[model samples]
Target: MSKNLVIIGSGGDARETLEAVEAANQAGTADYKVLGFIVEARYGTPGALVSGLPILGDFDWFAGRAGEVVAVGAVGSPVLRYRLVERAARYNIEFGNVIHPGAVISSSVRLGWGVIVEAGCVLTSQVRLGDHTHVNLACSISHDTVLDDFATLSPGVHLAGRVRLGEGCFMGIGSVVIEGKQVGKWSVIGAGSVVIRDIPDRVTAVGVPTKIISSQPPANWITQSGEK
Candidate 1:
C-alpha cells in the first residue's frame, strides 16, 4: 500500500523534493502517494497548484489527520526548516525522509526523519545525518562525517572524511570542508569557500580558508518571517 505524504513548503526546494519523491516512486524504492504541499497561510493559498500539486492547506490541515499522513520539510534554510518541523509537531504529525533515486547512499549511512538527500548526492560510509537535514544536489559527504539536526548543504559542496557539522549549519554552494574540521551550530559558510579549520557557532564565514565575518544570535536565524 502507498502511504500518504505531504511536503512542507511551496518554494523551489519543495518542488525539487516533489521531483525526488516521484523519482523514488518511479524507481520502486518508495511507495508514497504524495497528496500535496502544506505551507503557511500567509505564504500559500488553499486549492492553489504548485508543480501540478495542490496547496492542500496550512499547518492546520494536519489537524485530526496526523495519524493518516506523513510529512517532509523541503525548505533550503536550516532554521526555517526546523521551525516548520516544530510547527508540524504541534499537531502530532510524524516526519518522513525523501532520498532521490539518483543519489548514492552507503548502507552504513544513518539518516534521521524529515531528511532530504537530493539527486546526485553521494553519502559515503558511516555518514550520520541528523533529523531534518537537507543535502542539495551533487554534494559529496565523505566517510565518518556527521551532520547534526537541521544542517543544510548546498549544491556541489564537498566534505572530506571525519567532518562534523553542528545543528543548523549551512554550507554554501561549491564549498569544501577538509577532513576533521567542525562547523558549529547556526553558522553559514559562504559559496565556493574552502574550510580548513574549526568554525565557531553562529557566525558567517567566507573566502578561501574561511574567515569569520560576523556572528548573530540564534533568534536572528530562527525568525518568524524566516529571514536573516
Candidate 2:
C-alpha cells in the first residue's frame, strides 16, 4: 500500500503545502498520497478538497486515524502553530515534514517536523529549519542559516550564510539578508528590502537598505518580485 499522509489546517500554509505535494508527485518522488485534510473545529470547508483531496474532518479526526496516518501541521503563524502542536500533543499525535523535489538541500541540513521546503529553494550545508517553518519558491538559504518555527521566506527572498531568523518572522519577496544577520521573532522584512544588520522583534521594517519605520507592526508583510 502507498504511504498515507494527512495534513492539518486549511489556510495559506495548507494550500502551499498542497502545491508542494503536487510538485513532488509530478517529479515521481512522492512516496505517499494525501488521504485528506483535518482543519480546526468550525474552520473546515467541506469538500474544499485541494487538488481533489477532501477535507476529511477537524482536529478530532487527526487522532481519528489509527497508527497509519501521518499528520502534518500546515499553519503559518508561529503562535498559531504552537497552539496546534500543543493541542496535538494531547492526542500524542506526531507530525511530518514536506520537502519538495526541486529544492536542493544539503545532506547536513537538519529539519524538524512540518517544515515545508518549496520548489526551487536551496538549503546549503548545515542549514537548520525548525518545525513548521515555510521556505517558499526560488529562495536561496545559504550555508548554516537557521529559521525558527513559523518563520516564512517569501518567493525570491535571499539569505546569505549564517543568518538566523527567529520564530514567526516573515521575509518579504525578493528581499535580501546579508551574511550573519539575525532577524527577531514576529518581525517583518518588507518587499524588496535589503537587510544588512540585526532586526528587532515585533517590528515592521522596509526600504532599499531596510529600515524600521513604524513602531507598530503591519497586519501582513509581502513582496511580489520575480527574481534574485
Candidate 3:
C-alpha cells in the first residue's frame, strides 16, 4: 500500500524534503505516495505543482483530510516552523521526518518526531534532537547534545559535546557552538559565530565569543524591560 503524505509550506526546505521523500519512495523503506502540499488558499498557488504534486488547498480545507495523510513542516525559520506545527497540532496532524540517504545517526542518539536530518550530517551517541528540529546539510552534532523543539541549524553548523539549544532557536550557516554551551529559547546565532557561553532567551548573538546584541521580545514574551 502506498501511504499518502502531504507536505506543508512551499520553500527551499520543502523542496529538499520532496527529494528525501523521493529517495524514501524509491527504496520502499518508507511508504508514501505524495498527495501534494498544503498551504494558505492565497499562497497555495492553485495550479502550481511540486514534482507533479499539486498544491492541495488551504490548511483549513486540508484539515478534514489530515487523518488520512502524513505531513511535515518544511519551513526554514525555526520560529515560523514552530508556529505552523502548533497550528497543525490542533488538527492532530501527524508529522513525518525526512532523513537524507547519507546522514549517519548513532543508535544511542534519540531523535524526536518530525525532525529532518539532511545529507552529510552526523549525529553522535547520546544526542537528543527534539521534535520538529532540523539539522541541515553537512552539520555535525557531537555526543550528548540536546536540541530543543523547532530549533534549526543551517548548512555546515557544528555543535560540540553537551551543547544545549532551546526551542525555536536558529543557528545560521556555518555557526559553531563550542562544547558545554547552552543557547536559550528563541535566540539566533548568526553565521560564522562561535558560542562559548550561555546565551539569554530571545537574544540574537554574533561574534567569536557570542555577545548578545539587543534582543527583541519573543512572540510569547510580554514585558517592557526584558523581564519575564
- Identify the candidate with maximal lDDT: 1
Q: What TM-score would you give candidate 3 relative to the actual structure?
A: 0.92
* TM-score ranking, high to low: 1, 3, 2
Candidates by lDDT, descending order: 1, 3, 2
lDDT of 3 at 122: 95
Candidate 1 clashes between residue pairs 3 or more apart in a chain or in different chains: none
* Candidate 3: Cα lDDT at 80: 69
Put down candidate 2 lDDT per residue, 45-141, tens digits, no spaces: 7677665788987666656555666767777655566667656656767677788998998999999887888889988999999977888889999
Reference-based lDDT, each prediction? 0.94, 0.80, 0.84
Worst 10 residues of 2 by lDDT: 219-228
Report the C-alpha lDDT of model 1 over 75-173, residue by residue, as the tens digit.
998877888888999999999999999999999999999999999999999999999999999999999999999999999999999999999999999
RMSD for each of the candidates: 1.7, 6.1, 3.2
Error of 2 at 212 (Å): 1.7
